[model samples]
Target: MSSQARRRSRGTLYLALCGLVLACLGFGAALWAQDHTTWFKRLRGGNAWSLTYQGDAVGGQGSALTIRYRFNPDSFKPAHRIEQLGRTHLPWSVHALVNTGEVARVEVEPEGHTVATCRILLDDVRVVAEGKSPAPGRPAVCDVTTSSTPEKWPR
Candidate 1:
């Protein structure tokens, strides 16, 4: 190619690259803004419930568990309950009423493996008691705890 043509081609490539980078950054900023807005709304709404657990290795690997319950602001009924375990990234959520009581129990049992249990005590909107039991046959036990209130939650 001629020198002038090559220079034009390089300039076009650089412009395209810059455009792509700016597009990505703009998209990322938009996502971040949306997340921050949603979080702030939830905090202001004051109707979020959560349970976090760390359990022993059930099968061959350690267990990472999270239980989240979102309640309706007007009715105080659970809008959704999400439970996650292990490394599986499944969107497993159930719409049900999770009674607000002194204790909440969550258990996970991988097929053919012993059960890992988390017992949490609820004090109004805070978790007052948290405990975990290892899988039936496993000697390693996992400890579970709840995050602080929304106002105190880390950003």
Candidate 2:
């Protein structure tokens, strides 16, 4: 064809390559997309954050699950502090799932607040969780289960 036509085609190809690169980046983001208050998003406590998560929130027909974990500020280099968790932490209100469908009743409570007192009802379901700040001079600690298992992460 003509030189002008060839040049135009070349320019179109460059633009197409750029578009493809951006599309790939977008797809990558979607794969990594996470809810703002997702337990694993704003992880803190440094590497000491032993994240024990499971897909038990939803039954057999569910696509998402609620995760619970704990962190001790002494788990890593103290300088990093809570930076590892980004800006995420417990929220007064959040979302989780249940056996049947969406459990939009997830509740975040300030550590030390009444665990049972904080509950939200949406339509006909309720989601709940609680937080407990470490006792003074004890650093931050979390108990994910009822068993007598207390873990301490030393820096």
Candidate 3:
């Protein structure tokens, strides 16, 4: 090949290689940005929360009661407090108060009962029952810690 032609071809190949490297770097940076953005959104409470609780009823045939609370992303406060939305099938009324993604307090009142009130605490996977009318064989104020997350609770 002529000297000038050979030099030109080499220059073209170099430019193509450089372009490919830059494109790969750009793609890597974009992927990193996307991953970090998703993490930030979760930390800022941009993701919805689904808290579930399962335990035996206070009385009457020893049936188990399952309570599920769904909190929209907007309803989650920086302090980890979630406001009750509406229209839930929770057997008893619940006051959603979550703290630090670990501790949660829920006030419950059985149906057709006005005097008895109960409080449930979710300490990570552990569930503590308190107040009047607790489950049989379980103390009025007791902690029943489990090794499961709220999402993994039985439906």
Candidate 4:
């Protein structure tokens, strides 16, 4: 082809490339905006719920051996145990925010005369579900399905 024709073809290709880049950028921005909106969050999970995991040394001094918990049921992976070198002190608590309709669970194993407790709370006040160690020196397991709550969502 002639040099003039080649120049024109290159110009068209450059323009097309610029348009494609602009289109991709616009699409990415739209998706990012949608994801940050409330409606998208509600559709994915609804609202954020609160969870608490606690342990107390009841009789003699007690320490927690391991604490296993899940904040999201879909992934269903227990968090890593406390990384402290020695046993973690009792009467300790952990708090987390999870998505609505997800299962909140906590399991605590106490060494010595300690008790483990787990509670799922709404708005940091209403107790959705709670469980304490059956007895001292035993593991306490607590689980609550967020969908079980009678209260409306997006509250």
- The residue pairs found clashing in candidate 4 are 55-91
As a TM-score, model 3 comes out at: 0.40
Write model 3 residue lDDT over 1-155, tens digit each, in one string: 99999999999999999999999999999999976875665556533333343223443323213223332233345344334333223334433333233444343323333223344544333335555544333322222222223233332
Instruction: Score every model by TM-score.
Output: 0.28, 0.29, 0.40, 0.53
| Number of the top lDDT candidate | 4
**lDDT per prediction?**
0.42, 0.31, 0.42, 0.64
Ranking by TM-score: 4, 3, 2, 1
Q: Which regions of candidate 4 fall more than 4 Å away from where they truly are?
A: 1-41, 44-46, 59-61, 72-86, 148-155
lDDT of 1 at 155: 25
Cα lDDT of candidate 2 equals 0.31
Candidate 3: segments with Cα more than 4 A from true spot: 42-48, 58-76, 79-102, 105-155
Candidate 4 matches the true fold with a TM-score of: 0.53
Worst 10 residues of 4 by lDDT: 76-85
Q: How do the residues 1-155 of candidate 2 rate in per-residue lDDT, one tens digit apiece? A: 99999999999999999999999999878777643333342244222322321211111221111223322334333222121122223222232212111111221222222221223322224222222323311212222221111222111
lDDT of 4 at 110: 85
Q: How far does residue 53 in candidate 2 sit from its true spot (Å)?
A: 24
1-155, model 4: which lDDT tens digit per residue? 99999999999999999999999999999998966676554555435465665555555456788776665433233232322223677666767755556666767788746676656666667776677788876887777666533245543
